[model samples]
Target: MMEFRMKRISRKFSSVLAVISIIIISVMIFSYGCVKKEEKEITIGAVLSLTGKGAKYGEAIRRGIELALEEVNAEPNRIAKIKVVYEDSLSEPQKAVSAFNKLIEIDKVSVVIGPVLSNEVLACAPIANLKKVVILNTSAGTEDLRKAGDYVFRNRESAIPQAIKIAELCRTTIGIEKMSIIYSNSPNGKDYQNAFMKRFEELGGKILQIENYKDGETDFRTQLLKIKESHPQGVYLAGLVTELAYILKQSKELNFKTSFFASAGIEGSKLFEIAGDSAEGVIFGSPAFDPASNEPLIRNFVMKYRQRYNQDPDFFTANAYDALKLIAISIDKAGYSSEGVKNTLYSIKDYPGVGGTTTFDSDGEVIKPIRIKIIKGDQFVSFEKQEK
Candidate 1:
């Protein structure tokens, strides 16, 4: 009876010991897999407006990122080959939220670089903050993006700087004593108009007229005629590339030959295509990389971008390129984790990039100098920089 009892006790003890050993081995294996996963692959995601009103800008951003990733992946000493995944937000806020959720929950990306429009960024940025993912917005310039979250960062300057620069250029460089303004009825358009008017008047320049049209308005003959009646030396037009192009075309049709000063939104080859000869001599503040630049980094980037896309790169391209490079720099400097990248991004300063010397301020807004350009013939030539 005693021997049988001892045998039962020995069997129970052996069974417990076996279970403990299995659990330890399973935990060790799981931890090793996680370490290997972190060391091998880094996933990045994007929520871009590939099929909506913001498609052109989004496509440019996508191309820039692709070019940058190609170079990054080719580096032999790279920590991990970055894998990018994209979801089209269609430039809609609700769609952008869905895309953000998909990237964070399904794709498991540590960082995201898009949602190109300001409205889209506004929708997606808070979710990124909650989910502990880093978001780098390439070109969304609305002041609303500034309030998104600490995880939100922008690569382009907002309308304030561009608007102020335009006002200064009209006053100092062009010597314009009187200006008429026309803007689209969007948030950016309204904000830019107010900024330019405030700064221009403060500089002792007169605003003769202020006109506005809806975003998709086709006929601007009334506004153009009113602006013509003002007889201002300079007409400041703040709008998207398409709207500005249409305005230029219509203004030319109305025989309004007054010199035009536009926002950076008009800085692209598409404007010339739409407005043709009407785009000539149109001065605007541009964030584009100078085509006549001799800098090696600028030259190399331009060559590669042109070769890949078969066209000249614009500010959108340059800013997007810088965005990806900044992300990579942060990842390398502070590891691939979300918190690590977020912390490192704030520490970056004086990053001499092809776009400009990029440095993030306390609000995660990029501070870079913008150049004033004149649409001379078939090209945009650098007229000068805003006087201090």
Candidate 2:
């Protein structure tokens, strides 16, 4: 009886061990099933200022990108839905680099949209090149950024065209033989000043004086007074709209009545709002102006922007919208692969955009139309359109 009782106890213990082993195997299988493997998605990244001095511009760009994605997703036959992630660069170089690193290394985005400022773009270029991520810039116009890497692409014309346009205007329309340059000492400003000076001198235009103001400096009365004393035939303001407005208002106050030919700084409506009547008659180089442009895409975009934001789309916003569409089109044409997209984008020739027909050269700088716009009665009126 003792032996039989011991045998029963052993059988029960073995049964319990078997049950426990079965449960352990089941749990292990369930956990293994629940473990996530690496999944791939169509990822794109954007680095915009969004919250700093250039917030308005950044917000507009972000809105444009969002709208493009919304449209692409709404299509039933869409190739593959893109997942766009954004980081605020604050228009700073280091921050821009960090944003690029996060997008490339962390998010694994195949394509990147800009750090809008030229300096920030330049800072982020090396990283994009190293990571083999395609970068498309909407607004950074520094000539050097275009040549930063083979993967770098831009939708906007650089300051060189604007400088040449202004030089032509100064020589012909304004009848200015001698001119003075009042430029902010930022990278973009300095780039515009240098390009304008070089082109103006090349065009046989004389430089009466050149003055530089540091960025974020509110006081330009001293600069205005100096420009006034120089008595230039025309004054080229090479800065963002804020500084340009200050210079214009101060020029008016200081009785400096030199006809102004500006760079792309005066492309937005905010310039007119900031400078009021003082902004009138100011000729600036722009990509194109079509309050009544016939392009259906532009018309649709303008209508949508007005309906949603209750404001007209500026050149920058238009460029941003086109930038996203260009990327989308490239991806679609390339069959949703990174190499295909890059190769297709490089192969894109004479792709018509809202701004104009854009063709990427060997260096990826977009060759497109550049226009000259004159501010007339609180509106930008196109004065000239040069087709490349």
Candidate 3:
């Protein structure tokens, strides 16, 4: 009996040892810079809304990422051949968490590019911090991301910068002292509305009324009626292209003659396609990217993007291209470890990107110039040019 008990105990001890060995090996490879020279390729994960409501943005972003991937692989001084594994987030929080777990566990990726929406970032950022995985957010611009731990870094400016700039422009430039806000009733939309409201109020503007609508709602007539009744000098919209386009179109149908304003993220060609002439004269703030730019970096990126995608790169595409380029640069400079990537990204200073100069602050938020843009005829032109 004693001999049999000792045998059982021995088996249990060996099992525990095996588990520990596996964990130690995992930490060495993933947590620390213990990559082998023989390993020629490193896999990174991307969680994006490949399908569902945010699909348009995802497709545009995918184009930029693919272009960058081809360039990265063909570089003569490349660190390692990089592969990006993508999972559909469906633009939902729970789905994003699942995608993140699968990437970190099954795919064993130390870095991930995105959970495209702001709420998705809020959902996955905790796990990113706990697991020591790096997140290079492609386009989620809520202010809350500034506190989303060191592992989270953004490729684009947060809604705070653009929101603040738009509010200032509305007050100082457009001379609109009162407006009404229509925003999506979600994490991202709420953040954008709140930022703009606070700034506008500080500049002595009165928000006649505030209204929120659920995501995926087609008809915004009811909200428009309420906003129209408020009789504000202008109306500020904060939501996706699908919803915002409809809002602009319906506002015109209702004959609500107020000027229209929006956030940077809403600048997409689809808006013009949907709203037609209603989209003209709408003002917003953006992170200074001009497809017509004479700058070599901007020109090259625009040319390549158009040649490959057969479409002009918008805000989403510009950020996605920069995100991939930064990721490759980070890996080359600081190995494939998560900490190495995080530290290197944070250390970046005024790195000229197609989007703008990218320099991360202490909170991992990108520092870039935000300029106001106006929809004129069929283009987003610099508002300053009109002033000049």
Candidate 4:
């Protein structure tokens, strides 16, 4: 009887132990599945001018966004892994529209980063707004963009602020009572010209003459001659890099002695190469981004950019970098969906960026403080304001 009872007890205890083991194993498997579910994935798109007149700017912007992508993925607490799709806009309006459409319908990306020209951005704005897709333009700064749509946003200031700043400098700082205007026939140029003229005249300055040259026109001799005939105290050149350089070169040839002022359109080493010594004394308004800045965020970015690209970064590069990182953060705060990101963006007050502190107005437009810089000995440096 005693031996029978011991055997029964031993069998029963073994069965109980096996049941407990199965329960523990089941719980472990469920936890693993939950963790796997938490690690999500998202996708974004870029429509850039990969092969066209604006290719260089687009390439710089691409480098900026890529660097941000790396940082975003490497964060340990990131809620999602992100992938980017690229489409070449060729820097044309019609091409930009096609790229925007494909990204929305085919790639199914909710957020997009580029199409560097103002015209290209304007072309894509309607579609993006209608589809509820988010577009953060890196370089386009036309005033018309202020009313483009609720879904369209830009990293830099519009033509109005830059134009107003330059106009103020011309009258108060440079003490120019009379000035002439030379502009390109593009939207970017026209916006700057219109705004600057209105502001300068408001400040009691007189406009001597206004001249315009078509886009892709390498020659500005006729316009320069006409400007020289005005013989104003200063000339506001609202043109891009190549055209501005040519204007400076030709203006120098004509001995058009006057103060040269420009909006934020003229930049890059190529300008110095083409304009040569004529680039000197060309003052322009620039967003406050100095690579040598001691601010840790800026310093770290400059170091990383140099290490990767083996070159110093510029204004456009910095803007693009900020644009991508902004999207990533907005997505994290909200979700990867376009409506989520757009709502979060509207709630943003002041965002600390590598370039500067960015704050978007109700129109989805941002305006940072502008720094006055002058070309001195083939390099840009801070210009000192004169005492009143």
For every model shown, what is its TM-score relative to the native structure? 0.86, 0.85, 0.88, 0.91
Model 3 lDDT on a 0 to 1 scale: 0.88
List candidate 4 segments past 4 Å from native: 1-39, 385-388
Residue ranges of candidate 3 with Cα displaced over 4 Å: 1-39
Could you say which candidate leads in lDDT?
3
lDDT of 4 by residue, 187-218 (tens): 88999999999999999999999999876788
- Stretches off by above 4 angstroms in model 1 are 1-39, 385-388
Q: Rank the candidates by TM-score, best first.
A: 4, 3, 1, 2
| lDDT by residue (tens digit), candidate 2, 199-304 | 7788788898899987667789988888788878888988877778878877887777878988786666667666788987888888763646867877887888
Model 3 agreement with the true structure over 1-388: per-residue lDDT tens digits: 9999999999999999999999999898874553553357999999998988788788778877888899888887465789999999998889999999999999999999988888899999999999999999978878889999989999788887788888888898779999999998877788889999999999999999999999889898999999899999998888888889899999999999989899876688888888998988998878767777899989999998888767778878888888988988988888999999999999999998888888999999888887888889888888888879
Report the alpha-carbon TM-score of model 3 versus the true structure: 0.88
- Which lDDT value does model 3 have at 245? 89
Predicted candidate 1 versus true structure: per-residue lDDT over 1-388, tens digit per residue: 9999999999999999999999999999999977785578788998898987678888889988988888887877677888899999987889999999999999998899988877788888778888988899888767677777888888888888888998998897668899999997776777789999999999999999999997667789999998899899989998878789999999888888898988888877778888998999888877746756889999999999888778888878888888888888888898898998888888889898888888888888888887788888878788763233
Candidate 1 TM-score, C-alpha based? 0.86
Candidate 2: lDDT of 69?
77
Candidate with best TM-score: 4
Q: Which model is ahead, 3 or 4, in terms of TM-score?
A: 4
